[model samples]
Target: MIPSLDWLLEQADRKLKKEMDPDVIAITRAVITELAAEGLPVGVAQAFRTKQEQDALYAIGRTRPGKIVTYAKGGASNHNFGVAVDVFVYADGGKRAEFLAPPDPRLKQIVAAMKRYHMQWGGDWGSFPDYPHFQLYDAVNGQPKPLLGPRYPGRPLFAGAERMDRTLIRLIQKRLRLPLTGQFDWKLTQFIEQFQRQHRLAADGVVGPVTWRHLFGFQR
Candidate 1:
């Protein structure tokens, strides 16, 4: 009874004028078309569940149905925000009007489509693994400028190492006058690790920012 966000909400903006993120919507339509081609008529699900439906469900002894359905934070779902979609599998011909499987062959085709478009399939989640779900994952730190203020207060994440490596390696080579030797290939890595230890950072040799500073600024 969730008053889902149907296509109607997408057509003409009544007040909010805001549209769904284009990438998410495009990926969704592609999956739907591909699923149809594979022979299941899947349509979008109700995204924004109506208040009436919420009240009715509340009356029916359910305060939050997502606690029963989802593994992720309940209201803070991709579906609720319209970046995710759910598809059902209904057969073309049947003795009675019915849908046989959630991962009907048709549904599998949708999964394939999502992957081709670089979208993540919900079925990949080990904890939840919703086969009928497809979602555009939120970008982490791929932006030109990293977002300010830590998302986690103290979680110990070490992302962006690849790009960070190129920069740190350059700084280290310039500072200590190491044999750049035209290629870091191996020797430079060993030098960087020793440099990291002398600087009091972990000697992982991964050339993080702190390691870069010690190699260049602190003259270690």
Candidate 2:
């Protein structure tokens, strides 16, 4: 059976309706349905991102010490406002996945889907090509949709409490080279605390702005 879209939406964001614009969601759903019908079952890898998350991705290979993953800064990316999503084409009965890189044979299909839904594919960009990204069109140059606003403000999202955001926890695990359990378990908490201590931030297990800065802003 195919994965439930509702569950996928929840995985993308806990407060999806609250975090994402209704128009984006509608267009994305239509695109997904068309893709599924065309036998290209795509799954949403990312949808909404906080400013800190975007900054962290942008910091890679720049201010931070890793391969550059993005060109957009915190407020620059469409993802920071929940109008964008990253998708992966599933293979092997959804066990394996394929990232839609440039010149890939599958890109034509994805781009077509994006067009049908009035979304823009990042792969078409001349500079800093993003293969797996798509976003709703902004109301410019004859585009039909207006750009959405940010959902997560540029502030500490967590303090004095444990975070239940599976996506953020998974990102932290990937950054720390830990197993991607997608769970903020005791082990992950310990790791976060240690990371915080080493970074000269508060050793609280809570993942606040300070921790996010160190986690995604720069390398150790």
Candidate 3:
């Protein structure tokens, strides 16, 4: 028996709610709903990937035996930050997923729906056109930046770190109203410590889950 669109949407929502950022979840749902209204069977294929999972995917065609499927490694893709999702078209009575490439007519409608929600379609990429991918966009000077509050980096950030994800650093700097140097410098550390102290948190100049929650106004 063919699954109904309501059932498909419910399954997609269950997947989307797993680890996706709240704002992305809303926009994805809205996009899916709009497409469904037009009788397009679209659903979420992947969302909010972990760094380890991303690394494994990156290994494809390089270390692993499959074709190259992704360009971004761990912590580099928007999926790691919960701001990206890959969608698929339902087929075979909604029992199979079809990741259509470009030059397909349905892709235009899907792109339009994603654009309505301020999302950047990977299909539009100049080099690696990923037709199944969509991500929220907030560019700065022609560089892509995440649009939602970033998920915790799974580790504390402090001064003297070898390397840090510039996106998170920039978000922290913006929140603190400091220079957007995208660095975990001593000045940024001091500001984070001060903000922690003001919020009755530990003043250790570290950005862990608790401090991150406070920094981004997350309740949990």
Candidate 4:
């Protein structure tokens, strides 16, 4: 017997609410709803993970006894930033969780649902395909990218500054989907202003701690 849609959705919601970013939560919920409507026993296997949890998973193949499960270490995975999730299908009368690979018709359906939300699927990865993984995509490349925590400097970053932290500038540029030039240029400032307006922050074209938090999807 297949799992009831309510049971699957309840499980998914519980996991997703643990630490998932709002955008990730929304997309994952939509995917689960769509697949479950089709009679697929879709469920979330993993959601946002702390750095310690990520490190433990990383050690599974290297130091622990298990097959290699992931390539990212602590702070390197999208999961560490609440942007990624691993989903599974219920089988054996909803008692067994199954990860589907390519050529599986149900896997195809799940992937389609994810794509509807502009999600990036690990199954589509060229190397080390992870059939159970999906993530929010970067706007610039439409690919999964790790979201680092806010690495704020002491002062605000603004255009026309004599000197700036190139690394932080690049990170902001990446988040804003601008050219990753690592320079505080006028164009980048404009984009920052736009983002601030969209998020209801001050449209001052300055990147401060608050702006940084918003840019990286952190709770204020």
Query: Least lDDT summed over 10 consecutive residues: which range in candidate 2?
Result: 146-155
Q: Model 1 segments beyond 4 Å from truth? A: 1-19, 48-67, 72-75, 92-103, 139-220
Among the numbered candidates, top TM-score falls to 4
lDDT of 1: 0.47
Candidate 2 at 196: error in angstroms? 60
lDDT of 4 by residue, 78-148 (tens): 88878888998998978889888879999999988776555789888889888888888632234554454
Misplaced by over 4 Å in model 3 are 138-220
**lDDT: worst 10-residue window of model 1:** 148-157
**Can you write out model 3's per-residue Cα lDDT over 1-220, one digit (the tens) per residue?**
4456678779788778657767678777766776777778887889878899999999999999999988888878888877788998888878899888767878888988777556788877889788898887622124564444456787788887757788889999999999999989889988998999898988999998768867773322
Scored by lDDT, model 2 comes in at: 0.67
Q: List the residue pairs that clash in candidate 1.
A: 3-49, 3-50, 4-46, 4-47, 5-46, 5-47, 5-48
Q: Candidate 2 lDDT, tens digit per residue, 1-220?
A: 5555554444434434557767667556656666676677777777778889988898899888988888778877777777777888877666666786766767788887676455778778898777888877642233456433222223443323344556666787897899998877788778888998897878878776446645664111
Model 4 poorest ten-residue lDDT run: 138-147
Error of 2 at 1 (Å): 8.7
User: Can you list the residue pairs that collide in candidate 4?
Assistant: none
Scored by lDDT, the top model is 4
Alpha-carbon lDDT of model 4: 0.80
Identify the superior model by TM-score, candidate 1 or candidate 4: 4
Per residue, candidate 1 scores C-alpha lDDT tens digits across 1-220 of: 1112333233212311133545556545545554555455555543333334434434443454443454334334555454555655433431122322354665566666666555567778777577766656543223232122111211111333322334334445666577543345456667767777776769776654345434432111
| TM-scores for every candidate against the unseen true structure | 0.42, 0.56, 0.61, 0.62
- Worst window of 10 by summed lDDT in candidate 3: 138-147
RMSD of each: 15.4, 20.1, 14.8, 12.4
**Residue 59, candidate 4: alpha-carbon lDDT:** 96
